[model samples]
Target: MDSDIFRHGGNTTCDIKQFTIITDKEMRNSMEYDVIIIGGGQAGLAMGFSLKQKNIHFVILDENEQTGMSWRKRYDSLHLFTPRSYSQLHGFHLKGDPNGFPEKNEIAAYLNAFKIKNDLPIIHQEKVIKLTQNEKQKFLVATPNKTHKAKQVVIATGAFYNPFVPNVHDGTANFEIHASQYRNPSQIPNGNVLIIGAGNTGVQIAAELSKTHQVTLSQSKPMKSIPQNIAGRSIFWWLETFRIGRAKPNSFIGKILREREPLIGNDYKTVQNNVEIVGRLSEIKEGKAYFNNGITKQVQNVIWATGYRNDYSWIQIDGVLSNQGRPLHSFGVTNVAGLYFIGLSWQRKRSSALIYGVSDDAKYIAQKIQQHEMK
Candidate 1:
């Protein structure tokens, strides 16, 4: 491999610092790679770094202007439930108190720094529009700028790309809101605010906004929450020690927990006192939301922290994705050869989606790719 291709023609050895301005037309018209990784979150970046370590000819395509844009775009008050030490990428540890969970900005900065330090090849602002398999079993990745041909393609886009809002009510258009549009409490006018979901995001946002506005949280079912710490140890420590996050999805324990566990923030109980919990919104008409329990409420803002849906319509490969649009895989390998998925929940184990756990999945996929290449 020519080292110059990895270099920036400057003293800097970091690929993140070395800027390259290749047009989409130029990339589509000319370049090809051994592998092309989609998404630039922790999983994608980790895979790219691992590929670079193996001297594999690969490139990563990200829709953002920089790596870790997903974290950067999150709500301002967001913080990881897991501590900073646990969130470190492969070959690098976060530079701070190990027990402390960093804020969103810190996480984003770490990912950016990790890419630069490792010289991972990433093309930002290059969105993948479609992915198709050719007759030769190679991948054709279509992006806004160009089409890329690669022997293998890794889809590392995190699960949070598509926001899941429930079907709109009759009067939904009359009211304004979706959690994705929420940047801050100021974006909502002062009045009663109805949050339509009771997940971690909905609960957290409700807790924060309740300080100034009357808030009501609507849940379709009763929610459960676990303390961030139990018996003087972080919840994560217990989970890791017992391999809770690594449980098989089909196992009895995994099935029970997945169905019963209510998504909660690091401080679950503390948030409940800050917001009013109510039943699901059965209907909405004339600016009033009707709950299942015969409660009628009038609200000025509705934050739909419902959840997210996975849509891989852009990917044209057959038998790779399940009916839900999530890639069907075992240890990151899809049904289609040379096409893989990472950073998905329950992809390899329960912990596959966590920032700390994604590197392990990436490593596994990287090793698999290496094995395939050797053959």
Candidate 2:
């Protein structure tokens, strides 16, 4: 990203440098560390900064080719839902107005600055394919090309795993793309578009496509919406002030907050009236999509904006994961010695997986690692 790529909301130019982007082949055949953190998203980066503050030896490994490609690869109009004040990680302040929301690229740039400023040790293009414990009571992380050893392993791989695209067996649409693969309006075919899943991504993508194409949102019911701002303050401010975002997972209030409520930001305001809402997709056959309510539409483009599922097949440890393949950690610490997780939804609280909230989990994990070392 260019240094002059300043956010108009904050009118601040990014002055910090970027980190070195390394590839898998460039990685050493073998490496060792006091701690190895997987996934260089907000959670992993936060842990890196916290560990560096304590002079701990650690390395962050992510499969992305660039420093912040995770956000950079998202759709063009994507922006942080929360205000800038609520979107920063540890050690590095985001260069945008506290009350303003930053676009996706701004976030990618901010993370690059965060990595460079804190001098976080990160290995790009390195995907951990397998994780197991050796008899020596240390972790052995295996990638396709190399192996790494660490006293502790922190899987900070943030959420948003594999895209869950519903397969209709019979190809009814000319083309289909998931929101993760969606870049811009041009990605959609020339004719009408059908968007599945009424979550945040589905609503956002439908809004974007309505600019040049007729869009029909296919879902069981319209996503619930909440006002982004209340009176003169952002909704996040209220959430923090009322302690709603930090509510316990099992609490009644937390359960209500965790329920998916599609937020319509500036991205969807204009297209709200232009798109059509339909029931859940019941079937697809002969170039026509049918919904549960007997609504049928001919669409050339289809966007599967469904949610994701956790994939921890690499973590070969028993009893560490639940039957559904989610990490069973308490505030980022697992019963497994020197094993931990961060950036998991509801890992500690409602905001635990989000950018603004990941630092809390990371800091907690760092302290736990330090305590474990003393034992």
For each candidate in the order shown, give its overall lDDT on alpha carbons.
0.77, 0.80
lDDT of 1 by residue, 1-375 (tens): 222211222322333333344454555455688889999889898888777766777888888987767787888888887876567676466666767778888888888877765667778888999999788888899887668899988998876778877665765433466787677888888678898988788888888888888888998888788766688777888888998878877788788877886564544564577778889888777788889999998766778888888778998878987788767888778777788888888777777888878878887898888888887
What 10-residue stretch in candidate 1 is worst by lDDT?
Answer: 1-10
Clashing pairs in 2: 219-280
* Model 2 per-residue lDDT tens digits across residues 183-237: 9997776988888887778888888788899888887665666767789789888
Give the CA lDDT, 0 to 100, for residue 373 in model 1: 87
Q: What's the CA RMSD for each of the models?
A: 5.4, 4.2
Q: Distance from true position, residue 311, model 1, in Å? A: 1.6
Model 2 — which ten-residue stretch has the worst lDDT?
A: 3-12
The local distance difference test score of model 2 is: 0.80
